[model samples]
Target: MTEAHAGFAPTGACWICGGERLRPVTRAIFEFSAYAQQDPELARYTGATVEIVRCRGCGFAQPAALPSLPDYFERMYDQRWSDEWMEAEFRDGTKDLIFREVVARLSDRVPARRRTLLDLGAHVGRLIQLAAEAGWRAEGVELNPRTSAYAARATGLPVHRADLRDLEAQGRRYAAVTLIDVLEHIPRPVEALLGVKRVLEPGGWIAVKVPHGPHQLMKERIRGRVVPGYRPTVADNLVHVSHFTAGSLRMALERAGYVDVSITTAAPVLPPPGQGAARAGRVAVRRGMTAAARVLPFGVRTPLAMNLQAYARAFV
Candidate 1:
């Protein structure tokens, strides 16, 4: 069962571990009025809210409240890519490479002939497709009606076009599950994982991936001196709601009844690592840096944490 609280707060104790050593790391203020004045849904927001709590014991940075469910997903959930870009970035080859590793590792965690794998918040079923090829019964969930239909049609797999909140009522369970870059968007990750746990067989694994803050770089156009500790003055649809250090992530999984957890730093192909990092006047230099990232050994590549890929098995 999930407990209702006034949102994770300063001096409010850690939500994952119940430790009280909380700290205020940074403050974020949102002003939706300019955008809200034009949009109907945006008007519901309380406007600007200050985020001021961090847990020193577990390194979990919890905001008071997150963007409402619809506002977070409906309007901001556009995964559009241009044609040429899609050709280069959306290759099944890239996806297969990533999923193959997970499937192989997960297979060792459990043994069965026809294993079932459910992908929460699956987009286009790319991962499911790869898992299917690796000899598992793969399926996915999508909120977008059109994309879910397309995924079902393309891959010949069942894709539930619904949210995780409603999944239990549908009578679902799986041998393995995945949530790639999906945890940050939800208003409540704990409840979300509880739902995930409900659907997985005991001893099965849930593999998770999310963007590590250290690796994302955005150029700031400014008029003065550049220094350390510079974050974007504002955040938008792409804003990260929950931020987790390795410790916070481990605690989250531990609380969810997952044992023998491990987090690995995996390199996610940056679609066009070259194009995004390229500068107007310094193409050659930037390309070199991008290539370096490709071969760079996985370690604390600072300013960007290696994209957080966590693997945990359900407790036996």
Candidate 2:
């Protein structure tokens, strides 16, 4: 299939595998933000077309092209985004559970006597805080100055306002690296992993959490056809450039030279903004999901959940 184009530029090749063999997945021309639908001034972006494509070579999915994102992101975290998201995440102990899972996975595979963790895209520094509490020396790399500053002030953890690429210049190595919900937002995920490889100690581990592909959006895709509220668009998630299935995520990790790579699925956590009656219903659903997640085997959840956690170790 011909590569899809967005506005003026061509998407070139798959960001994960550098393949030109692409398959068209879906197309939409809708506003990314729910609020944009109500405001005429902001609604101009509703007309912009976006095409989601899957790479036949690597099974990776991404948009046809990524537009200039810095401006959008700067405004997003500063204005629309909040540290409350992480606070809420911890309220139910999900983030803490994830931290323990990552630590245990690395402890089993990496024979390092001491563990030092670097959380890439560590917005608000909750992971670092959790790691430090668990006896791991932790620091963070964040791109947003505001969030980085907040993370340092709130958690007293050292969070550098820079990208993972900047760590190569510091010459510091870590025993573990984390990318929670971070990989998909990056335009060059493979290149970022290469940088991660450079900054890790031998036998060090990396843990990543990302949304499960195609399936997470299946309902939205079906709904957009019949309901205006569910129209598929990239506006709200303008920062996310890629989507990963279990196969694609594992492939990316192996391609970057990781060993003993393990991927597992977790219970689906519904996004926020629940109404009065619906909010109560969502809470009940979440409670049930939390219970099921505790007992469900990894084999059963891997194909059914909406999120996946991956752990990989670097080798000599």
Candidate 3:
């Protein structure tokens, strides 16, 4: 094992509630080479095993132990893609449905005069571009150097490669902020939300989207039982350090001082173009699931709730 793997430390408290009563859920080995097939830089830690634990206080799940490396997340996400791949990602329309929903919701809530928006963890600035077209003065905050540069060049807009606290220090404020598929990867989610809140204008709205962690895990387990040679990969190598349910996600936002929080089912990414019957069938299933989830109460626990979409206002 690498020193980083050998030096793992227990997560002593719940990230959301600071609860010490945690129960072991499962363990999974990290086949780093398999996961790194596309990003060869992550192949250094090949044999690390991670344990997931659920907090009894809030029912939030997270890694029982965390890697000792200080720069673990940075190293894990340091992908080097070719310019051609980046261009393709920039033009992909799979997530356009999600981007449109978020923008529409924000436009309804935020006033026209205060239409500045910030997209946190902007991958290729696709959403920012769409928001710009929708008449919002949109910008982004990306930590990855390559993606930040590419997004800025492609969109002709500012993409700051700085931490949220740095923007807060600079008095940068926006009427709306978004963290799409970004919160799951962060640890101490409550603290992260608080930092995001600091950069928002008073009464500004924040939108977040994350996978329904427990439901996703259940699906993976069922698939493993029915499919041949299938391995569950939800919390492998602690890539997703925090796993959230509907209740836990709301609790995190509330504890971080957000008010008027609302959560619903988020739209799924569409399949690539021109796959014929298979793509059509997948789209039908996904749309049906999303529609089913919308009718049910947000507090109701259901498998149809594949992903959670949350909007809350910072009402300080």
Candidate 4:
């Protein structure tokens, strides 16, 4: 693994809209040493800092500086997990609400005959399994060899360890594709989306879920103020490289040639194990927020829309 201590450079253009009207939103010291504790690959850049900037034109936020190392993201995400932990993750139902919602929505949009689905970044193949159970001929594209192999073994499905371009080159097409919690990690979201468009069948639907960047930031700020000795981790180490508002996300899909776009509040990942009452209360509050956001006019602009879910079709 290559070290990137002083290898940060400015991303001069906005990732979503390609605009130069960017203003700094926040700056934080990214302690690579702390991350290195999990993945020793980052042991080189022990002390580093980066600025996150928001694009005035598109309401999208991104790290002002990108690592000079081209494979920085790959190295950063190359996590080594024990099989025990992976197994636990595979069995975790905390994300079942999200997976079920996506699968149900995709099923409703695509006809039964054209129910072939591809889950991009299918971590551990949980979504693939659920989609399969839902009667979709589901498969996945996962780059990590460990997770891809695990997913294939666990689900008895072909989890391709290839990039979207590679899959596109193979002439594979699907009725639907999903990018749950995936797009925000990519710096060039529109370019990646265009690649997704090539792998879809004509008029194929795409389901995307991403955190509402501005609202999430506000929540974190409030939490930090309320909780003593708390620190915000939303943009830590630029893990979430692209922060998107609902408008920006819809615009990104449209710019990538997707039509019939619809954006709404997405389901939340259930909180980790805790007291039954507290967990239920949190889930109830989150579900209520999502339900309310679905009905409210201009809901995407409200703070209740903490996460954005979008359904769009590739141009016919």
What TM-score do all the candidates reach, one by one?
0.71, 0.77, 0.93, 0.94
Q: The CA-based lDDT of model 1 is what? A: 0.62
Point to the candidate with the largest lDDT: 4
Task: Tell me how far candidate 3 lies from the true structure as C-alpha RMSD in angstroms.
Answer: 2.5
Candidate order, TM-score descending: 4, 3, 2, 1
lDDT of 1 by residue, 170-245 (tens): 7777888998777866544666677788778778789887655324322321311275665443223325555566
lDDT (tens digit, per residue) of candidate 2 on 175-229: 9998888887776677777779877988888998887767567646667899967
Candidate 3 displacement at residue 48 in angstroms: 1.4
Model 4: per-residue lDDT, tens digit, 29-51?
66566575665546565567788
For residue 137, what is the lDDT in candidate 3?
97
Of candidate 2, the 10-residue stretch with the lowest lDDT total is: 1-10
As a whole number from 0 to 100, the lDDT of residue 56 in candidate 2 is: 91
Deviation from native of the Cα of residue 60 in model 3, angstroms = 1.2
Candidate 1 vs. truth: CA RMSD?
6.9
List ranges where model 4 is wrong by over 4 Å. Answer: 1-6, 34-41
What's the true lDDT of residue 136 in model 3?
94
Please say which candidate is ahead in lDDT: 1 or 4: 4
Question: Per-residue error at 148 for model 1, in Å?
Answer: 2.1
